[model samples]
Target: MLVMLTGAFGNLGMATAEALVRAGHDVRALDLDTKISRARAAELQRTAARAGINLDVRFGDIRDATYVRHAVLACDAVIHHAAILPPTTEHSPELARAINVGGTECVLRALEELRTPGRLIFPSSVSVHGPRLHERPPVTAATPTRGTDEYTRGKIACEEMIRASRVPWVITRVGVSPDPGASSVTLDTLRMLFRISPKNRIEYVHRDDVARAMAAAVTCDQALGKTLMLGGGKGCRITHYDLIQTLFDALGLGRVPFDAFGDESYYTDWMDTDEAQRLLNFQSGRFEDYQAELAARMRPIRLGLRPGRRALRWGFLSLVRPR
Candidate 1:
């Protein structure tokens, strides 16, 4: 299968692309990384090559209908993971709309024109539930969307655009707490809320699980027009404070003071897994186990080694670091 992976240069994008290549699919990556750092480009190239896979990297803004059309025309299936995420969206709503909302319309139009049975896999977020925690109970695909923040609103709007498209579509409403392999808002919030041992509850999933669930949806005829809520494994639940303390203890770092200004929006209400398990045979990992792995990886990095610009430079290199 030829897969067109949008935002392939991003953290989640890279993970998904890597998964596709490993599964022996022809992959092409599209990102607005026209001026991507030399280090990043080289790393991705090397990583792809190491896997005996070479990805065609196309630099184009997704909001541009022409560029999006061209990219879609070149592939058989589409992993539409591109979007403007938080904080930045909070600051600039227009950019978010132009990219997240406008980009979806462009992708859908491209699919319609191309007349391909292209699988449109949209990795949506739990944020669409809005920043507010569910006062009633866990959230399911049928839960009413009430996004209070601009970023979440943009994501919701993007999905709406995709739904209106007359194309094969699978939307995954992802939960918080990324696998150790991906950058996570959950980790950052935990660090901020409970430097010593912050206590809270949240859902999570591994990046690998997310990537596979998406790929499986491509071949699952029953998944079309379905929105599956994906989360970590059954035993994945953990209190926020306990998770924080565990990290602190595991890292052997001194307790750092933290203040809690609860952002209920950060938490994704529990996911309904029945549909996902049945349709995609999806399986996810618990945050605690993933955190343990993260802590282990951090063991080698010298303590108190505050990252500077080199971190960004090195981070770019790490993106495509030899598998």
Candidate 2:
């Protein structure tokens, strides 16, 4: 199979690309012409060579219909992971819509024009369910989508467009994916942690697990035309307070003061992924595995930051008061 993976340099996209190659499929890795993408492309080439796999790296915007059409041609499937996520999406609504919504349209059009339309594996977000009250049930594919943010709204629109199209589609609503390699104990991260309500539930899915899900969905005939909820299973589900404290302890930082944290306003909750797991067989990671990875990465900086941990916490609190 020859697969086109947009945002191939991104955390999820890179994982998916590697997984596809490992599964004996060639990948057309497409992304924007940026410095990061260029650097990652070189790394991807090295990695692919080491694995004895074929990888074609292409650079262009997803919003460009001509580029998208060219990329979509001759591909057996497409795994779309390109999007402007929040915080960034919140600040640039128009750009988010152009990329997330319009970009998807371009892909669908390209696929429609093909004599043999290929399957589309769209990685949507659980955020489309909107902010859930604490007592709400675990979200399923049947949950109503009520996204107030531009990013979530764009995702909803994209999902609808795919469903309405003639193409075979698999929509997987994913949970939070924190890159373990990028995890660090920073002031800004601490501030964000302080703001999250300790009681709110969050599902943390590993990137590799998410990649496996995408790869599985690509070939799984049963997954066609299905909207699945992809999560990390029971071992990855936890409350915000538990997640923070685990990270803090792993990094040699003490537990966060309960009084200092505020109620979370952002959308996040545990998902019912039983059906998805049965169909795709992609759950292979646990939250503890992620914490261990994070701890390993933090070892080098732990000693240097240990002495200033208290100061860092106080500084973060002073910079942003919890709501």
Candidate whose lDDT is highest = 2
Q: What's each prediction's clash count?
A: 7, 1
TM-scores for every candidate against the unseen true structure: 0.80, 0.94
lDDT of each: 0.70, 0.87
Error of 2 at 44 (Å): 2.0
- True-vs-predicted CA distance for residue 59, candidate 1, Å: 1.2
Q: Which stretches of candidate 2 lie above 4 Å from their native place?
A: 183-193
Which tens-of-lDDT digit does each residue in 142-212 have in candidate 2?
Answer: 99998788988999999999999999999999998888787434556567767877887889898899999
